[model samples]
Target: MARGPYEAAIPAKIADVDPQIDSRTQSLVEAATVEMVRFDAELGRDSAPFAALLLRSESASSSEIENLTAGARKVLLAQLGDRSSVNASLIASNVSAMQAAIGLSEDLSVENIGTMHHALLVSTDQGIAGEYRDRQVWIRGNSPHSAEFVPPHHGRVMDAMKDLVAFMRRDDIPALTQAALAHAQFETIHPFADGNGRTGRAIVSALLRAKNVTERVTIPVSSGLLTNTRLYFEALGAYREGNVAPIVELFAESAILAVDHGRLLAADIESALRDYRERLGATQESVRKILELLPREPAITAEMAADSTGVSTATAYRAVQRLEEVGILSPAGKIRGVRVWVAADIIAALDDFAARAGRRSRH
Candidate 1:
């Protein structure tokens, strides 16, 4: 019996991703670098909140990505506040498995494996969450012999994952190159019965985070991949043939593109924030005074802002009006005098992030 593509599926060596700098590639990287530097300087004060919200917006758009995001958020929020009611134990478990599977740690323990698989299975139970197949799975319509076929030992998928985790933890290589190679390897291994694609993408994010490649930032790589799924799968197929160069190049190129686009997004947000800040001016001092008062009574009248700011009721109304205009606050309802305003800027920032990310996914 011949194994054909199935036998030749896994990669044996790490992909060689040379840092060979071509003028054009260097130019693109350089531009993204400058823009990122500028963005960081301008938005450093607000990066934490911005990153937290953006992570949620991007991850929730997809089921698999959402699980990892949920896990990370759970950890992040618990450190900041009491998260007893906002539990995400299963998502956290899955994230741990991803971290282990991708070599973020020295050993992939039984507990880690159990956690990820449980998340995957339970995630499916919620709806049509991606599920694993017990038998060998095939790419539909790709195999020449048949429309679809499964390998015999599909249940041992986790065994392959153990090997993957070992490979990810191998420190003898560069992180960028390791990331690309590991992604290909994980996909080839097809460790899970289902959710492999999203899970694999999450591993890439976790590896970047672990390796300091992203430096507390998540690149929306899946949006780039989803833009051209054909090319994505083709690169995977190329890896199956023992040619890693193409896929490595593809990943690097995508990384460059994503960073460049993200830089633009950062600039847009920074500009918006700056505009809102400038518009507040002297009136902003009044608004701040009003905000200080709101905690005691979140639902207050515009007159309250005036009384707190020592301004006339008309002046207070105008200040609240400005905050509403810039998305800094929103009225509680259609009620006239006693209007409640909430911090709306955070939500707007998140919305902008999602829209830009969605556009990237469509591209």
Candidate 2:
């Protein structure tokens, strides 16, 4: 069924920016933005191998998000940076839940997002992984000293969601506005027993991709929201009362910030590539040779490298090892026999960028 525009609980209007934000909060957001830009740039240029490793790990980690402790997340992230040939199946499984949630699959008949609870739980090993509440429960914050307000659900929530997906898939609304509305509506639904926050953020990514507001950039807006848990919830709560302005404005602001960060990061990468190219000088021949082999066979083995480079097996391995040492490539896993070297991080980043672009274009 087709969806249409989502209406807020109450009609709302965009707030005029207070020129008074010369205040502390504004200054802090500014500083954080700059810091984020610098970090993103630094990471972006050199991110290929690490990004691939992390994303692949993310795919695996997402499956087990319910089960992973803080320590486990740290351990998994740490171990991921220098590995390759990580199981593609594991990576695919991690994203499977998100893919299904967004209805990205060709097999639309499979199941609803409700079924993903098991996948998320199995991935995370959290006890609440697959179970839905048998009884209606009040949605409450876990903060200290807060009395929770349990709103009555008179089926408005489900109706709003069906309305929202319709809004997202429509061509009439502006992409930016549609993306924002879809996000707010999804959060308003709060359908799941747990993992709503993460799922909501993923939906934001999906909607942005669907709407074409952002291209080749994974905004990582959740990281932004994580900075102010209180304000984030407050804005979301306000949306529940039918006020769309705050959430819409918040999303627009976040999108601008995310894009600014992405641009800086992309610039840094271009700079690094230039410098790296200059340093190679005449031995640049090897770099060219490697580039030729990368697309045809990104996964390089000792024999494959030798055959591709027309160099001795030992020499090919040594060159490949040098690239790996400098963060350009890495071993897929620890089995050691027929070990494959992959440009995991860069490939993953490119893939991420492509996915983001694809989603954005769908808008």
Candidate 3:
């Protein structure tokens, strides 16, 4: 049934790539880049708080690309330190890794890539958390002979990764194109034993940050890929065949769709914020402070809110009580023993975004 294990994989040198993006694909990349800039500017315009909602969106959608599914409530609970659902915890770890990528964006080196991988898998699979594989790795089958892809040998992993990092640091390439090629090349390299897909996607996020395509908000490009993974995979396959345009075009299309969907999610968040404003007509500073924090910290405790808002525990609890009375916040069970309050509307909006992102068809 199966044949030979195949010849040793030839590692491609990709440090200096000149992608041949066609006219249509080039236009699409231009349009997508402009839309991404516009979309980021629309939502709070460089505020760190807004990044939370979309970062969660991006991470969850990215995880869903690998079939790691979790409802938004579970993910929010996990973000608030719940960690009950295995999938939710994993998705949350993906979120953490994304944050790590963004944090390490300024550096963008081989070591930081390992650090991002470590952040992603340390909690779930500590043994191989940040370490590159020392053995051959193949994809999609029981043995290398039947595998869909056999990456370069472990000995070549670091060297190829170094080349990729070098490519990532270049300024001649367009941000979207660079990110696209970098992602496909990293996937081609397949440096790590596990979590390659997620880690590779996270590096895209980092590249966007490093290139300054997005400063405070994530584009959720993976959500766009989530819509039609067949095409996405086909594009990756084409990349391996030395066709760079397909992946670049896919990233462009995904960016535009992600921007459109992100706008809808932003509308939902804006509406929730408006509802909070109406319900919080004559609140005190502490109540106002906690309310401001709700978009970023959907599931918050009184103590946590107090510490964040620089108020006493009693003041924070009173604020939570006021928000709860106004129907903006509600109890979401306890974390350890303290009752955690959640912004139900915010979580609902994010869940709706995730649902739409995961929905089939792209129009």
Question: Each candidate's root-mean-square deviation in Å?
Answer: 9.7, 11.1, 1.6
lDDT of each: 0.52, 0.47, 0.89
TM-score of each: 0.58, 0.54, 0.96
Alpha carbon lDDT at 337, candidate 2:
53
Clash number by candidate, in order: 4, 28, 0
| lDDT score for residue 35 of model 2 | 42
lDDT per residue for candidate 2 within 3-114, as digits (tens), equals 4432223212222211122244344444544543444355554455333332332333332323321222222322333233233333343444554444442221113444
Specify the poorest-scoring 10-residue window by lDDT in model 2.
Answer: 11-20
In candidate 3, which residue ranges exceed 4 Å CA deviation? 1-4
Of 1 and 2, the candidate ahead on TM-score is 1
C-alpha lDDT of residue 109 in model 2 = 17
Model with the higher lDDT, candidate 1 or 2: 1
The CA lDDT at 115 in model 2 is 54
- CA shift of 137, model 3, Å: 1.5
lDDT of 1 by residue, 1-363 (tens): 334654323334333333333455445444534443444354455465345433443343233233233333233222223234234433333433343434432233334533444444453344423434455655455652353323335655556655666666666655555667778877776655566665666666666656555554556555445445556778887776667666666666666555554565556556655665676655557666664443223234676567666988987887787777766666654333344554444434444544554453443
